[model samples]
Target: MNRRTLLTAAATGVAAASLPSMAAASPAMTVKDTMNRTALYRSSARTQLAALRWGSTTARGLLEQVLAHQAEVNPGVNALATLDVAGARAAANRADQYLARTGRTLGPLHGLPMTVKDALETAGLRTTCGSPDLADHVPGKDADVIALLRQAGAVIVGKSNVPPLCQDLQTSNPIFGTTSNPFSPAHTAGGSSGGPAAAVATGMSALEVGSDLAGSLRLPAAYCGVYALRTSRGSSPIVPTRGHIPRPPGWLTSSDMLTLGPIARDADDLDLLLDVLAAPAPADRRAWRIDLPEPVSRTLDGQRIGVWADDAYCRVDTSTRDVLEQVTREVRAAGAVLDESSRPVDFAASNILFQKLMYATSAATAPDAVFQGEVKAADAVTEDSPSALYLKSRTMRHRDWAKADEERQKLRAAWDAYFETHDLLITPAAPTAAVPDQSSVPAPERYITVDGVRRSFYDQTSWINLASPVGLPSLVMPAGKTRDGLPLAIQIIGPYLADRSVIAAAKALAKLLPTPPKAPGLMA
Candidate 1:
């Protein structure tokens, strides 16, 4: 399809919700049309951009709609950590003027309004990362990813909330308090990208930039019933070279598993943001240019797919298992050759290695006193101690860390071998939908109940661990809802550097799956 035809489809088909309402200022609009315009704010980012391109709405008007919706809902959701109203409005005005005068867009995302995860720094915008110490912290320059987003003509409206240091599985900090699940205020939004997920799900923003290392990005996307991509890392760098938290501002080194990605309400939006963000960081731009490959297959028919529905080591709840079963059946009915018995790597072993390497990398920022304390604790603890693994991993020797890194390489090789025959792998994004609010409880003491039995809090990330350690492209999209009416989702994993393949699968599967239900009162 041509550009105008694509835009027309986006306006009429993908965003049926947007067509019910017209621009608020249109003299032809009726009272109902003006009332329905509130839902226009919830339209997909692509639809909004299409409307802007077609002269149906101005950038400033779209920003106003988003800001108004956020004002109405954020008090209850607490999704936004900061707001740059004046700056965003000014940028939107410039976008309007540029398009009107030049008859061309700034870029693919021209005039798009969205939020960034608090973990990512934005110039002149306070990014506390939900920490008290950095409550007043503001950067003078944007992070590499933020700069890229701006170059694509995205307006930085504000920053979303996150857990302190982006460490916990639940988003809560002294600075922003706790972000509630949009579906039910009683439930916790999964973290450390919880705020971004909630914001996207509830229409506070059209898209967001979030980071994931150990399910931070996908877990929340699953919990809130949105889409997120944990882009692959290979010969090229897919994330910012610096300015992410946990390394402190200005530090260049970060975790090997940690990666930055896009979060949005649909797969097409994920593709749109990924195109703008897949390039190298500023310092390497002159020498490195990324041209990620196209999808392996555009349709499910004739595709070779693998299903890792549930594992004995970390089983999902009944609801999640049912969703996986339904998805696999749909894939088979669609003529995809499905393999249900293939195990890419040993799940138990891979998770152990992931934990060790994750802790070792996180140890870089540990204070001298804390490292010394962990060393002492490691000497005193027995293998039976509950904290033994953590202490040993956090205080691991350089040689021990090297061994773990080597094991990760073998795991990656195993995944590559599996993909040699299979086009994609499907699994649960989490063991269950959004778990009950656990923000009031401390991290170590927290636990999630599965099958009416208490499971380790960290198990929420067990399924997600498979993709992170191996540096594969992973996409999470809503599958269905639990009996309780909460959102549930599946994870699609692709070969290393084949990011587009997973997104393509997601786009195809989205047609077969039920549209994720919007949050109750807020979306209504």
Candidate 2:
């Protein structure tokens, strides 16, 4: 997912189910998601749409519920920045009118409400992008995904918050303060999509659209104990780039990494949204009526899975590791053959090269008037210092980026080889579990805390790069929680573009895991 505006992209809440259930209470992979009434915060596009049809709630009614909830709890949790009561009400009213006049539907998302990330424009609504400069800017056209959702009848609820230019993993900007994790308000909801995560985790809305470049979407999902899909890069309709973007066509193929998809409460719900978003742009495949491919696994009965809980490059918090271990054990006990073997993958080099290409992509270019930041940084560089490396990388020559590209191909090839023997792989989504806010930390120093403990600010990207570089689909699902009650998650990665198969595996594995604990923040 492209979490930052640099990629110019695409872009949930919660409540309880009041429906009666005769099904046995057990680990709800999708069932707990559909049945949990304590308000576990993240919303599923599938669940929301189903509720609209089955519960007689209009778009306006759902918006009213979130607005009312926000009024009572937003001050305590700090999730929303801008709420589009009027715009959302207007959209909801239109949906209600449609339902009244015509039994026919607008699309799959009729009457669903989604809180959009502010980085993407929402016509007629302010899109601040967490920058003071964009605090009042409003584009005439909606982002591609927004228009698609609208066609499907998703009411725009208003803009969520982000970090400035989405330069940090923690969400905090001069315009919007910070988004705290619902599990523990002092910790983060994870950025640059934190606000949406916080909002969804607090039961504010049912679904959210967020982007991820460097684990933004997945990290937030993990911390919030929700399900998030970071699809193979370019799976969703690509958004146009803005200022600082260079190169012909002004389109970015940044490491061919990063993605945009859905964040919900379970695997099936996550798939429901992913399918709707996967429709090729109207111009591209609507005319041809493209169909989605099935999941890679024949069935979960005897599937072969490769799992890596931790690695030498990054240390997973014990809780996160434990959750995955349990998931692996459960899957095995359920009859799937689990492989603890390491495949022929270049994780260390993949990450190192990814860093070079990623930062270069971020520092892509500047206009004549705004070249000051680059000039100052160049002048500030001392011989052979880290700044010099940055300067050299920033102005990356074709040969330099090509070198990284070659390495990327090698990594992709390595993945191809690995997949020949295994159908799927699982690992920790991030090294830590919603650590203290890191907004004030410098990029380089971000990896090394002021306390002198070394950690990779980019470490979260380690496992993410595997899926991204190869353009593979990865699903992040809650494995369980920590002794302290924090959420822990695992990533299920499938062959590039084999999304359906990954969904099947997650559903089967979900049946094996323990019942995830109910969150404590549902009271709000």
Candidate 3:
């Protein structure tokens, strides 16, 4: 089917709750002892794979542990939307059989159980993007990244929850309800990849593949106290926003800035998953390949770092700024060269351009009637007003888009120039920790307070927008916690395609910071 037709069908399709059952049943496997479950759940993906390869733990045993963990905590957070219990067990059995017969492991993720964001298509499994339109939609083939994971011997257990069409900051929709923060149920987990971050944090999954356009992956990782990588554009062939809904089925192109990446419990796992994901697509591999450079400095000593804790354009909360200050002091004391005043490009101009491009890209999925309404609204406002800018961008002419494209190139050039002297740039992931769940409120009315000031609802993306437009590689890791014990995080922005350098910095910083605590009741 064509993309337009698929969208029309989705709009008129039956509700997900009324769809026919598509899952099959398999014989139940015996549950392992509590100690065994705890040990496997706490171990990293690399450790789990080693155990599976050595025959200390079978693939089936690891799958059972994940299922048991899901049963223990999923009810409270609503992270996993669909569980393919039968199919996962069958795949685990086959993996064990192959390992026993050949005396060798299958691939990097051998015998490891994992979950994917519901936005990514999974063959034979209900791949709803948390919208009623595609709630019963099942793809006959896996998304490009999903196929790669399966090839690497990763067992897919289920799909995680997401917002409707993944257009919101909080993960909640009519299809699967809301995914709460594991730290506190009253707060949001962050979206469109909220479910994946929550599942990884709560030990329900070994790792997950998620996509980011506007802080989707980074914010969720920060809110959940996990690690997430926002890869450089086109570094991986995983077309997340394309196979994902909002664009509908048969759409082969995604937003220009959208990139697919990994979300895990630690920086090492991010590196492990990136090695498996960072490769050219089948067609591109015929003519070329991608080989990213290694980190400039392995340790903090002699490393050049730039810190932008708070900006006049977007000020972060006091607690969030405190953590960034602490990180800066520790890194300086550890013999690193830190620059607090250096900044790349212009924040205000770059942010405006980013919004123009973001809103313009989003206009592709807007219905015809909605687009027309936006055009009318655009004509009614002053040209320089914020609302006018948003409306004009959303319903812009091709010529206007051409102008924005030129500005984007200039911004990219400015960033390239700045990276010549700095290894990485550090900033707050969001203005504050996870805020109270505001899913019931409309998008325009939502607001958050930072340092006694009421800011716009969209301010959460202000600092994060720094890396999105230029496609710079970025990582978010737990820096510390708020006074109330909520998770606080910082973003490490690397030079274009310097993914390894970003991860290396995170690994070094992790040693100086407090280890992230497990969410309450996650292991119990």
Candidate 4:
């Protein structure tokens, strides 16, 4: 059968029975009982890979468990935009045969079934960026990151949902609708990578690849109570953005600030994905092999950590602040030196520059008609209106963008100086836990209640915006849960191109913080 036909069969929940089953029926954790399935889903990727190698579980068996979990949870959460069961089964069969025949595994991610955000194109699968215009769009090839995953023996199960054109902070599009928080249905799974985060949170997928531009990857991982890494973004960038949307399919170039990384259930899993996905662009790899720096210290002992708990510009809510305070106190107790007085860069100034540059880059990909509309809209808006800043930035002159780019270089220098003294900087992932589902509200009109006071909906991204503009590696890990049972998270920012160091810091910090919280609805 052709690719489209296979996808159609998979969408209809057809099992690929014609393919070889790959494993003996007597193996542990068959798709027979909930208890065995629970054990399978709760295990980490490393543990699962060991099981795969030891013959305790087959690739096809694990894929069945993942599909069963997805079938149970995805309807309520709406995390996955498309699922290709037939294709996954076929791949799993191939993986099992190779292992059984050669007594050797494929690669680091051998037999791991995972999902990618729909913003990413997958060969032969529908990849709608939550836009009606591209509802039927299916790429003939995979995104660069997806290709890397496939090369590492990962089974691409499906594509996760994203906001339409990935423009909003909430994951909802006219096509896939809204993705609810895995912890609570009333709250949003933060977007444009919300689906990937939620899927990882609920064990629907073992790993997910999500892109970040203006906190798209980290914010959702924070909200969904998972782990995400915004890979190093400098001269030697990690993951390429060749197949991501917003540049539109078939376009070669993506935005400067946009990046792709992994979202998974644990920090170590994030590290595992970094190993598989981190590579230079195809053109650069012929001569360049990017090697990120190692962590400053393996443990928290004698480490200089910076704690920016809350800020006046974008103050976190009381619950979030409490969690931050607790985390800091724990870090200090663990023998790590904490510095609270040193500010890396001014929040207000950096945020302003970020907005100006981000808006300009976002506008670069807009259609001619849409660009003209934004120009007209900029002229009609009042100087002090909430939308004025965005419109002006979107319509800024090239010289103005050049000036902002220069300022960004200076900001990068300031971050480098700060990291010279500090091993890692920890901050609130957002102003609060997952905000209420605001899919129906317009982007500018949405509000988040911080300390019972209404704040701008965009404030959810203020803390997260710090790492993106300066080309730094930032990791978001679940800190704890809110009083009302929502997820609270903290961001770990390291020096530019220090991607491994950032994940290492996260690994150490995780030891001091509380055990990561599990979502209540499905995992409860």
Tell me, what's the RMSD of every candidate?
A: 6.3, 7.4, 7.1, 3.2
C-alpha lDDT of residue 157 in model 1: 82
Candidate 3 clashing pairs?
A: none
Model 4 C-alpha lDDT per residue in residues 273-313, reported as the tens digit of each score: 89988888888889988676777777877889999999999
Q: Encode model 3's per-residue lDDT on 332-378: one tens digit a residue.
A: 98799999998997889989899899999999978899889989998
Stretches > 4 Å off in candidate 3: 1-38, 234-242, 384-386
Q: What is the TM-score of each candidate against the true structure?
A: 0.93, 0.84, 0.92, 0.93
Ranking by lDDT: 1, 4, 3, 2
- Model 1, CA-based lDDT: 0.85
Candidate 2 per-residue lDDT, tens place, 1-524, comes to: 11222111111222223222213334443323332442322345565666667644555556555554555556666666676665676787788788778866678888776787776667777777788877777666666667877888888777777787665677888876888788886777788778777766666656777777777777788778777777765424332222110121223333345466777767787677776777554455546543557876646767778888778776776666777778877878877778897765767777767677776766644565445566567667876785676665666668979888788778877887888888889888887677776667766566623123567666655776667655677888877777778887788888767777888887887777876554454542
Q: How displaced is residue 244 in candidate 4, in Å?
A: 0.2
How many residue pairs clash (N, CA or C atoms closer than 3 angstroms) in each of the candidate models, in the order given?
0, 17, 0, 0
Report the CA-based lDDT of candidate 3 relative to the real structure.
Answer: 0.83
Best by lDDT: 1
Off by over 4 Å in 2: 1-45, 234-256, 282-290, 368-384, 441-454, 518-524
Pitting candidate 3 against candidate 4, the one with the higher lDDT is 4
